[model samples]
Target chain A: MITMIELAESIYEVIKDYRNHDNIFITPENIIEWAKQFEDNGQLVLTELNKIIKETYISRVRAKEFIYEHILSYLKLYEYSSIAQFLIDTEFIDVQQIHKSQPAILQLLEEVLTEKFQVSYLPYKGFPKVNYIYFDDILASGSTIGRDLVIFLNKKNSSGQKFYQLIQSNEIKLSISVFCLHTWGFEFQKYRIQKEFNDKVLKKINWFWNYEIQNHAKFNNQKLNIAKPVKGSSSKINSYLENLSATKYEDYAYRKANTPTTEHFFTSAENRIRFENVLTEKGIDIINMIKGEAKSNIRPLGLINPQYKIFGLGTHFFTWRNIPNNSPLVYWWEVAGHNWKPLFPVANRGN
Target chain B: MKPSIRTYQIKDVVTFAKTNGEFGALSNMAAGFNLFINEVNIQSSEILYQACRFPLFPHIQEEIVRTQNPMDAKKVSRKYMQYSRQDWYSIKFKIMKWCLEVKLVQNFDNFSQILLATENKVIVEYSTKDAVWGAIPQDDKTMLVGQNALGRLLMELRERVKANVINKSTIIFPPNIPAFLLFGCPIEEVRNDDYFIVDLDEIYA
Candidate 1:
């Protein structure tokens, strides 16, 4: 069994930033005890797993820099050219917003932009319709943006005329400037938008983002074949992958990625205890957990209830703000008596 | 922390190939770039150039492929496994060596010296006789197309390499064996047949 001292040392080695300080959630001392819970046959060999947990973490420092360095700097450049008029998604303007969760990024953007540019939300009424730039942190499926655009365009004005109707009649051109796009989602939505609208409507869109990772169909197919079980563990992660039947999650297209995303593998303090309890009961059959054919006691993304066609586990995205629910049940989903702990603790649980 | 899976981006591949004088690969890349342009109508190789710079994350790659209606994820998996088993560097060297001997590439010595110079510049100094066409152009149109294609390829390479020289990490590519196949394969033929742009705006729109 690895000692608390050993676990702390291992964590420090990987998370160089946390050597002197504790993370917002898991501290080195806390992680040591947490590591003990995943012991297999009374042998706690979570050294590598601990390393993974630390490596996957994106501290607030890094997250802020990503926003400022990549996204905002580019936006500022446009502002300098006097061509940019910033608009945010209307969802950020919530009526019931507590603790100012709404428009936090916008507020930050405003502070950073330093009054050089204008940032506002829609029903952009009385404002001169310039190059309206919409900002969002991430785009996983592109469905969110599509839905948002549909809503924005369909919104009826005071005279009962919809914005989209006017645009369709060539009364006004609705040019969408998307920043921070996930390329796969972008392509999928791009195809849909073009099909939904005619050639003229499709011409007025521009996309600028930090980077687009490999999510093309051609590239992902190759990755699926090589997706392996996590190395050096007692869990049946590898066996589960090998035995996963094609028939399972057959209808849900997105679940087919085979390997769960690396981002979802961290353990929160609360989840660590619950997952350990489940681990004691289920005894490490990750494949069965994923299959979820017979057992109810599984991870959040694990239950495969067929509403979303969610694969039981794995997502590629990571953010400092919170672990996405779309990730595997083991990553963010936590429920008591289920013995389900998550790698990253979900923020605003039960919301 | 667990190390994320390392991926080779297009930029890394071009940097290596350009620096090492893999003329055949450049030809294939140029053809692919041309195909991408013909489909998308982008004036520059910036998309593929940018894509080349993007990392090839297996998780995203697997997800994207599986989502296809035909779902040839298994074939992709098999190919990936095959690639993992081979020595990537050895394969790269062998392919380059073969291309040189077969004259699929010309002006290797001159190109290599320029590429390897301390200043880190690519100087392509060649005469008309140095042309190593994959096949003889039968008509003026074909010859013009060939020249334009090669010209575009060379220009893009110089610009891309200059922009990307700062990436210090060494990268390797999966050998496109039967090296002639690499040069001859059109981008359209290799890309997902179902996935095509209905309108140029469908891509960026």
Candidate 2:
């Protein structure tokens, strides 16, 4: 006998008091527990209401707020400014505050440069560029420092291209100097090699080519003997570098190689096992064994065996005899411009 | 469109009798009468007299026949006559009240058109003047007759309508009531025993 209007009013009254309660923003476990209590009390409507409220509150509270606001700013002031100042004084570099930081690294660099050598703050229209690019600390991933460098480089090149192009054309020599605030060991080496190789390869191919090699050696620094297959032990250690799909293999082998620990290694391994199991279950005759030998303590090109020769990195063992009726690999080969293997002729038959 | 008696009416009553016919003589009599009257014209004086004269009928009629002078013939006749009128009036009032409560009677005329009963299946005649309007098959044997004999005439009316025997007349009820109230018999004597019938169009329209 209750009217729809009265039911709507009762629902509003139940929800109004708990609208902005801080307990609603408690952890997911606590929220779930509260929901269970509500359900037990025969309050199904209240349980759903509380779940929606808690989820909204949690989503509004952004993750990692302290790191963005506090830690990053402190690093820019004390560490980056001192490193920038050293770079300016040691070299006769013109340092300017195109972007500002707290306790101002660019300002400190400008002061040190004016005291040691000739320095001037360049306006947007008129700018002079000699050499040297500097940064504070380098991590395993070069993305952060690389992004900042690109922004500064773009600003320097905005006017006439005289500053950057003249330096690039070799009329004036441009040398990039990054003062190491801490040991940037492996990442620095990889970045330098990638830049040099990228420039050389671009000229020859008339296209930019970049690669990151994932060193699986970091997983277990000790060399793995591929000849021995240990029984009753985890095959995970052996095929740890094996199960990567073509795209994943390329990404891990190239870009993510520099920081393999940061990559979800376990998840990637599980995915590889799952993919291999699916292929095997489908009765694919392709090789399941990881190909190639581990050499010089590095799992090189031949170290891991692939079911298919992806990016032309490994050797093909057996081409499926039933070519036309073969699995999706045959279809892929046709799309990739490889000629279809002919059906066996009668002449090739033996008595 | 003309209405027809539901084919399930006999079966529904039979089933109701088998399930709920436990409460004593009146319930047994009502059930037996329902089965009997459905097949014969009880409105005819000859048939009603014969029916009332049955060995069991005397027991039931004795309950209705109240008299001060059993020896005086004229007084006994008047008393029996008055008893008949009172019984007929009570039955008519009870049926009318049931039709009203079930929302089958639309007006006073609708109430008059409805033929409801505890001991006979109910019927409603939408029109009074149409030819074949009062004609109905009282049983597998004889067809019903008479305009004032409400129960017999209403069944005949329904049969005529169903056979396309009457074009303009509408007959309602193999006693359609709301599904929830099918078990809710209001009459205390009949509550646990007999089935009641109402003509929906008579009240609802």
Candidate 3:
């Protein structure tokens, strides 16, 4: 049981630089005010919120060090492994083929690389290329990374050689290096890429991530450790789902929260449900505030594809750069004059 | 061999239920071969198939799906016998076959490779009591006897795998029937397992 003041202070410390209007970079008071929306469960919200901040939040320094470890130190060992035989069999690391999901992380990666590799990553094209390593904050649904790769692979460079052609030919390879990835979304992303190219380019692809969240609930054996509350858990949640546009109702979103195989992400199973319920309840309240025709992507927890129709993607991971749209709305939903203030003012949303 | 029985030398057939068996990945009870049907994560095909028995009682399906072990999931289903769908007796085998098909499609790479490894040798589910889904050791301990419905379905799956037709489908149609409901929703077609690939063992424990 954490006091609101103590929890708010710790949260403010972690996300102090979250951008705001006119010197409004988030403060402790702001955190307290936001939790009050939950009323009697306000303390519970703060308790869970504090848990999230303590366990999930990433500061700038911490993220940069991670980038160094994955891209340089860890990747070195990977090069000679059979998993990365394609990298060695083909050409040198394609240092310049950086797919930056956002400019800041790429810039952070470049800084980290320059410190270790001791070379300029940019302005050095035409080097013997083998693999492309993408650095991003987190891969929530994999749509952003998948879409980028699809567009990049389908398009030809100045030489009229499609990137997919290069990959299929084994002349070049691809690997995505991200901070964290969801087990379900990671698979879906790979599936999307292969489907786009008709399975001709998967062998050339490799994936590296420091953390993977088992948030998927498709399997009966799966215990969803992430924030998926069961339907009928509360009248409010049911009413919320029932209120959705009839033509756009998403039935798949109304699944019961499965037990996680292990309780690694949340502190405990009881706490996990309490946290999910409060956030989902508040998430619905927050979205209900949207003026009219709330965008299809606007979900209680976070944003997803407009066509997805599910309550958000329920991604809990965060990075130094920003929170992902796939995260719950309680973490990053910010709209002016809506009487709502997201503690972590997200950086890149709706891109 | 009886008309329904397909006897196989115990040494020639593959058996799975335990996670460590050579072809254990083919077992509906095996861990790590999680399926995502209709954009939902099912821990195994056994759980999903069992959950299908009580579609009208979604809460029971939810309880069944929440069980970590497939055997436990079956217990959960049994506890709610009063809520079992009326057509369960007639459609049970078809549902089991559909569930296995889902397991095969969702876990095509590993499951199919293992199914193919059986290599036309009569596949058998070694059992002592259950004759419907498995075979029992006959008087001769060297061979087995029973309906072996699971084994037959698996052999059919091996052919489908060799056929390589349904592997790419984004959605799998349910067995054409009067009604197939899971979680109170009509079963149309489930999303292909290709959408997500769980790098098991590498999976976060």
Candidate 4:
């Protein structure tokens, strides 16, 4: 068995060749130790994890093409519908807070979707607004869309129409278009929106996903169930999850499905303190624990969303520009002069 | 004739509820709590059995039978959100809170009857210090969704289950009457008069 230090060295060898603009903090050493503590069946080695990171990492070119083609096709299909008449007056929205910060895909959409359909940025145009499509990269818990909608609803447009008034008067419809959507998140949003809004307003809402992941953790889907911790680890993980703070509504967003492996071990720097306390209580160093006999619970998935019950590690989805905040805090959270480094640096929010 | 009746423990009910259908016996949990919850109507307390309760917890339901396929696996997550023992207690507490908030029942006895409505396959016998109020049907085809109902509507369900199951028990109580009953199934194949009770008191204790 490789020591934690050795494992870190091996990991460094693999990641060294990859791009590094903003230096990520967590070393291969930090990860190996964390993994040893978290995974029960301790067979995972540095080489395997390195392989997963290299293979799963999404590059800028691939992400742009995937978004452009999927959105373009979705728009083409809707072009012939009677709703097209209403949609021609549609306005594209920044639902994910990505328009200014992570604008590569959005720019691509503007180039292709705008050219294909008669679209406008502002609502001041004489055409009656019929459709509003909010674009984002991922939808994990599904609350962000509702949150953005609340923001949009309160803003008065150049036309002096409250977005909420347009929605109430049946003058406009709302929809969400995304690249990745989890099954549980989609249903939660569906039930929540239905319960909150009237039928007419609900009827005008739509959800479209380029890739609909049916990883709800309930079914016997072997591929998706890969994250379930076996016996010894299962109990430890369960207790850890059960004890997490459930103070917020989003914190309560848990389903029976196996917690996605993509969720990170820690959500943020503050979350790390509590997680470290659990390790301290165990009184086991990274190198001395018994070797695991089961499959590692961690997934090779690239992205993490701390909002997910997993403390922050989520599914393997990633984008080219910046790693999402949803990814494990270990990979993305960084403070000046801090030992912790983000493997995938996030886009500067000021942009 | 009266509908056959039996008693079960909540622990056994939890086990039976988790048996997975297609994965072979003991391979997977049959279905989650959501499948059972969808069939219940708390406000009306109306018992519905057919596609929802056919064979009273068959690997498949009427909808699955008619569709000739298993229920969509994706839906199980949304309906059966409880994953652990604590999760189950949390959901039960939610139902209890809802019952109280909605004024579904005035007292704890009637409120406890809501527990009888936990599963699709149930034998509910409602009574008080004086008389037996009503009982759910025991048949291969029919079962109860709600443990007890308050009015002419539940009277109708009781009649339907009894008639369809070829039993002849009449509704004996008035609406808003308070009563309690135990829910259970046979331990194995037994006579209509015989049943194996799960000793819910001990299990809960």
Candidate 5:
């Protein structure tokens, strides 16, 4: 059999080409070492993980293509289209100071705008006005974007109508563009808007996304296309679930017992079971090693609702910049005291 | 006597209620039969049906959807009676039938399996208070009487399933009535196996 380091060799080739992978100081050696954490299963896990990275790792080159493609699709604007006035009129939202991803995403958007359109427009830099367009990398629980948009919409302009009221009156429109979106996250965002503003304002907003995560994680869904575990009937999973704090999300604590009627996310049905089980079991072991109360949002698999009593959102999505905290912890949990090393140590986050 | 009672009375019947009985999957209140529509994860068809009552008030729809139980969804509807659409009474049957169809499409395996189990028998919703969507026992358990709107819809659904004629796309196209909405968003067409959404500007205006 190949050595553990050799097992990670192939992924190193892929990782080297992963564009925009800056500043976290990862190397091929780190990849090999990260795989060794799985010991005997190291080779198998790394191979499956390599497949995902190849499929999902959005190099800067690819992200630019995606950004340009989607922007054109949204604007119906082109290289020849009149964009000077439209650029000045759009306010790409920069409200998420609670996390680092939104700022980073805006920065990337700025670069793309300069390259693709030759507009000196810097995203998240100009005053809020005109047709509002919010840009973010991904939306998980929707708290950050929801809270941010709420603040922006409640603000009053010189005319004294609230931004939401302005939107309802058709003085301007709002659009959201993201690399990835979760169905639940979008719903939660809508719920936030409905509670704070009204649907009339919501109707003025549009959404554009490249990758859609279909893990609504509702109960009794037999075919899940996201990273959820095999059922928690297993002794370890059941015990972990039973011990969770009471939460309304307990209904989503497991993927349906019969799952992945189609394995759209993973390599295959058999491999999905293999990869998810290993990742979940490893995640639990990592959680056990936590020194104390691992924040309310932390879970065995990844991040979820603070009150959500499930394994996690099982987000398997990734980008060249960073893995979302909503992904399985085995991908991004880098606590200093923990025994396991994350495959992708997140950059620029307080975590 | 109600003139409609005889027209709706059934002798050979398969009844559903109590949510856990043999034919309970036919009840809108049954658990494990959820639906994803217009990007919202609806708790039950009852919640979806109640939500259809207030298309203009998204807040009411959210209140009903966030309720933990279906019975409470109805209570939530009654709580905001004034906000209900003016044309609700006239359009409710069309909306409820559409909600059931959505339940079948989204929860195809469990819903269709149970629906096919009824085979050729007349399906009835056993109810104590609601005689319109369901039926009331008139003579012992033998005679079930009332408008039986829900039962009639189910029988129609059963026949459609038997003949394999569901459009696979009507959940988003709900019988061409005005103001059929969830969360105030007009569902246009099924985007994929996942969601139903339309372009915003054309309909939002």
Candidate 6:
């Protein structure tokens, strides 16, 4: 009958000789010995074997860990003064801090507007005079944010014009300031202007308000009609907007216990210790045992209806021309029911 | 021992011809006869027994009936006239040679055994399960093609067996037949009931 030892041997050969890497050598014989030791120490089931392999080999590193160790260090030396200063001085800024920071920035902008030009704070009764838009870090693939920004800008610009007409006779300019200007914002602004005035403009609009459009020709000629139907469009958009609105002013706690680098180092060390402990308890040198098992030839279990007929014993012998006499005799023997066990030379020694 | 002669139907003749690669030649030779294997002559004597169904040439049926006595070899040969004697004999020789070569026949006590032996050496009849030609009747032209294919296959098997290419038998069953005809070798009916039986002893003897 096929035993756990055989399975362990096969698995060990597969894993050890994987990709022919010289550094990673785990033989079948050694693995079998290790498994026997584990069984002797009271670990019996194959599920336990799977657990041991997972604990020993599979490395665990979360997405958040990647973000902290690799992403944060590069972000520290950002050219933007305010964002860098904020991260350095406060250690971290949560959503609430973002809300607080926005108002202070706006207050500074208001002061600048007042001192620099004739400005009026015309608070529209129906819509709030001050509007804020929040986004996560690095807004490329502007498809999502572009749509939101366009709607907001269009509403604010239209309302700002109406407010100017109501409050002042002279043209009053409007300004937009975001926490960080993404590298591709200029392309998005150009795209918006070209889309809005697609048919009306004789030549493509080269500039949008004061933002100098980079890749203006590319944006102008772009065929930005909805390429394909978005999946679950109505529900997905509604839920995303709802979540953004709910968490607009919420505060998230920031605690740096250990960066992922140190955490991963500790994790590797812990895994090594656990492996060593298990090996010591079992009293098996795993690598050597697997090698030994691989070299041993196991006997095959025999066929169900054994067909053995000896004809013309002393006469002319006839054998198939194709099959060589020296070739290994491999046979499958039925063990219990439908299952068949393959016995190798070692197992078939007496037979 | 009485040598029994059995008459075969057109379908059976076609099948034998196909398996032996003589269908085309046989069909051409047997044209206008309306039947095949007319007056089965054993040794030099024509067997005259109404109990056994006999194939008769359409033109000589009246002559055969009036004679009442078994015709001489010359007379029987004349009555069972083939369109082309040379072509007919050549095709017959080729088919008979092929049958001998493939060991489709096994001799028991000097008689050619029509039924092949199973793995246990038990005589297996040429039923729908074992007989390659026992199936539905095909047109004369198609029968010719089938005969030719069977003949070629038999020759190949003969060479392999002789050389001992493999100890085991390597006969391939015919494929691509209508479901109804898929079961067995085609057989000719005599008197609409009597079926042809392979006589193993006579051929070997």
* Complex DockQ per candidate: 0.04, 0.00, 0.09, 0.04, 0.06, 0.00
lDDT of 4 by residue, B37-92 (tens): 11111111111111222223333332232231133432432243332123332233
- Candidate 1: where is the Cα deviation over 4 Å? A1-25, A41-57, A69-79, A82-102, A114-126, A156-187, A198-203, A211-313, A349-351, B1-205
| Per-model TM against the reference | 0.43, 0.19, 0.63, 0.47, 0.64, 0.15
What is the TM-score (0 to 1) of candidate 5?
0.64
Top candidate on DockQ is 3
- lDDT by candidate, in order shown: 0.36, 0.26, 0.68, 0.38, 0.70, 0.25
Candidate 2: residue A198 Cα off by (Å): 6.2
- Model 3 Cα lDDT, one tens digit per residue, B4-85: 7666778877765466688776667876566665555567888988888876676788788667578999899788888877
**Root-mean-square deviation of Cα positions for candidate 5 versus the true structure, in angstroms:** 15.4
Candidate 6 CAPRI level: incorrect
Candidate 5, residues B1-205, lDDT tens digits: the string is 1215433345678888689999888899987665666556566789988988888877788788888479999999999999988987777888777778877876666788898898888788888777887888776656777677887888888788778787444344565778666654565442222232221111101
Two-chain complex of model 5, DockQ on C-alpha atoms against the true structure? 0.06
For residues A82-186, what per-residue lDDT tens digits would candidate 5 score against the true structure? 566667667766776645766767676677878888875664347555677788878776666776788888888887888888888878777878877877768
- Worst lDDT 10-window in candidate 5 chain B: B196-205
RMSD (CA, Å), each prediction: 17.1, 42.0, 9.9, 16.0, 15.4, 38.0
**Which scores better on lDDT, 1 or 2?**
1
Candidate 4 residue-wise lDDT, A187-243, digit = tens = 445434333343234445667766654544422221331122222333544565565
Q: lDDT value for candidate 1?
A: 0.36
lDDT of 1 by residue, A48-109 (tens): 34534443444445544544553454346444433233442112222223422224345544
* Error at A96, model 4, angstroms: 5.9
As a TM-score, model 6 comes out at 0.15
Q: Which stretches of candidate 3 lie over 4 Å from their true place?
A: A17-24, A77-101, A126-128, A157-161, A198-200, A220-223, A246-258, A261-264, A348-351, B1-188, B191-205
Error of 5 at A31 (Å): 1.7
- Chain A TM-scores, per candidate, are 0.56, 0.25, 0.83, 0.57, 0.89, 0.20
Q: With candidate 6 superimposed using the best TM-score fit, by how many Å does residue B112's alpha carbon deviate from the native?
A: 88
Model 2: how far residue A173 lies from native, Å:
5.0
What's the true lDDT of residue B122 in model 3? 77
Question: Distance from true position, residue A288, model 1, in Å?
Answer: 9.0
Number of clashes in model 1?
16
